[model samples]
Target: MLRTGASRLALRSIAGPAARPAAPSFTPPLQWTSRLSSMASRRPQLPPMRQLTPIQGAVLRRAMVGKIDRKAEDRYQHEKLEPHPELVTTTSSVRSAFSEVATPEAPKDVDMMARVKYDFTTIKDTFDLSAVPRQAYLIGLAGVLPYLATSISTVYCAWEINHSVAGYGYFLSAQTAEQLLHFLEPLQVGYGAVILSFLGAIHWGLEFAGYGGNHGYKRYAIGVVAPAVAWPTILMPVEYALITQFMAFTVLYYVDTRAATRGWTPSWYGIYRFVLTFIVGASIVLSLVGRGEVADHIKGIPGAVDRMKNLKDDAQQALSHQEEGIGAQKAADAAKED
Candidate 1:
């Protein structure tokens, strides 16, 4: 009986939930199966294949070769169209480019000449002188204003010259000084007169150019004034005189003479044509006749600029002589000291 009971107990124990190999550990297998199912569902996908045929590759390669050959031929046709070294860079071409890069660029003379031509054209466009549209009173005032001022200034300058000459003549105790003074006084008077008259002429010329709507005249005027303003501060000793005369002549040449030569119509030439004609004709006449009569003829002429160049030349020569004399005196003094 006991054996029978023991065998039954042993059988029950082996079949029990805790003693039957724990149902062969089924949770692990189930967990593994679930994990495998999830991994299969999450797998990556691949793209479809692009099947390029052998014939297609051959065609593409041939096209590329044809393009490169065409490009080479084009480069040959244009001398400057050298092959790109990286793309088709030739050793000689690279060396040439490098050498050129090292060399300095040539000066642009053509550009400078073109600029001068443009400036010349601009200067020729401004010239007009008519006061008819202005009130008669204003016109008369403008005309007489400069003249009155000029005359007054001239008379004052002449009086000063005469006084100086008379004083020198008295001091000299002879009439020789008076005779020399007479000639010299007139020369001084002539210079002042010319300077004043030129002031008016220059003013009139510029006014005409401005009214005539010539942009070139404006540039010429600007050039004239520029010199006048620059000389006051510039370091050069000759700048004062040279700049003044340059300003005057430059304005006259570019604004008045050039425009006149171009056949521009004036509202009124007035006596200007006859005046200029006479002055020019007289200069020729004096030059041809004799030096003794030159002064006599110049007294009758209207324009002042015709004689200015000669006067400036004379003044510059005098200045040079004075400087030379000073230098010689200094040298003589140094020798005496030695």
Candidate 2:
């Protein structure tokens, strides 16, 4: 029993040393700690925003504008804007050129045709109106001059009519001549109106002719001369008889001339004279050769001829009536004496 007790005491002492923990093992978990630290260090960080200073912001804004890129500031800048866009100003050459070509108030001709009659303040509107009398006079003269041939024809016709008829018929012929003369007044007025209108058209046309340059100027000059030369040559016969024809030709000539002076294109042949001459000649021939039937409703020469014949017939009839009355009275006296 003594031995067994001693053994127990030894075992107990050994067991007592084992009862306390060894204060954790001597080494730590190095791999796990290192891995955690590395993970934390490797995580991405955000970049801080860069805010602009107020002064810098204002400078950038100003740089975007055109106010600082002025023409005087840089010739290069000015050239860049030319084909693109630039503000129109009084000094702009392009604008000035456009205005010169477009403005009506600006005169283009060397002589300035609008100034031909001095002092537009008093004359322009009345110029046409005042010209009426002159037109009337010219038309009347034209109509009257052609009547010479008609007058001879009329006297011959009248003498024949009187021989065939008597006194009252002669009186009728005289009255007809007076009536026809009265009708001529309106014809004169009509011719005057045409001339006045033509003059006005030509005046305005010349004002626009300057855009054609030197070649255009030459073209215009020739165009104006063409009509002027043509109408007068063509209307020679008409001017001698029908004032209306003269007036029409004159007006057309004036318009063509005016347009030509203004740098307008001329028609083919450059002359209307042949046209007028042909028209007048044809009309005169028709009246003189076609009998009084052709004279009927025909203006100018034909009408004039008809009027002359009527007048002659009236005079002859009156003379015939007087002769008849004298012969009858003498016959009655002789019969009473027998």
Candidate 3:
């Protein structure tokens, strides 16, 4: 079990056991105990972990990262933040002598666009309500008041018809309230159509004034679409009209947003339209619902009754004319027989 002859001689020399070992045949008595102990301790031991500083740790991690390892302490940092990344540009001209084209200088915006790596703010910081102007906000809100009033009045009228509330009925009779509801439906639809036309006209005005750069057919086509969509809704029935207007409002708002993004309109126009469109859509939905509930309580108008009666009258007249022709033919036959 001894590694070398020196170890065996040293152990023997420390004990001075050679004097007593001569009694044994060939094996020694103290050597057997040491051989058993050495066999028991033959397994290898593990080393302890080393503690490293941040710089050393970063370097170690960097070595493990890419194929061509980066060595600079200032560079290749773990999760490094570089607000202004280094730009390496050559000042000397290297273009061919026969070439006529010259290189253009890069704009500052080009550099600004290339933000630090893994920047979340670039993606997430999109919407800010404070960017919307106060005048546009207030005016847009005010524009929705008519729609709000009509929607509320419609709901209230429906509720009034179902339950006779005497105190409130003193100012407005149930019949009068019903009449007002009838009036409000047309008013609401007409108002919505007008609003849509007005919204569309803004684009035309902007195009005429050259508010944004000349957008050509793009802006002109947008100006025409709003009025085209809105005008037809006025001719539709109450339910259909409101629904069409709702869709128109939503589509127009989306168009406005695109226009803003394209720099054809003010930056705040999208949010302004969004707030107005939301209120207008809600009002339209409320109006439709209120009208629906009220319709259940009231009987539907007998619009087809007159048409049916007119059809019967026309059939009788046709039968009478046929009878007169048959009588005349019979008379002619009798005269021929005589």
Quick one: best TM-score, which candidate?
Answer: 3
Q: Which stretches of candidate 3 lie over 4 Å from their true place?
A: 1-129, 165-171, 299-338
Off by over 4 Å in 2: 1-302
State every prediction's TM-score relative to the real structure: 0.22, 0.22, 0.51
Least accurate stretch of 10 residues (summed lDDT) in model 1? 233-242
User: What lDDT score goes with residue 7 in model 3?
Assistant: 37
lDDT of 3 by residue, 1-338 (tens): 32344433333333222233344566557878687777658622211113444544444445434444456643657666654323322421445578544344433444443456326564334445577877777787888899889999998887777665752464576777787787788789889988999999899888988887888789988879989998887666688888989998888889999999988998878877877888898999999888898786565422234446778999999999999999999999999999
Lowest-sum lDDT 10-residue window in model 3? 43-52
Pick the winner on TM-score between candidates 2 and 3: 3
| Model 3 quality (TM-score) | 0.51
Candidate 2: pairs in clash: 150-305, 154-308, 154-309, 158-312, 158-313, 170-314, 209-262, 230-273, 234-277
Q: After superposition, how far is residue 150 of candidate 3 from its true place, in Å?
A: 0.9
lDDT of 1 at 319: 100
Give candidate 3's error at residue 303 in angstroms: 11
Decide which is better by lDDT, 1 or 2: 2
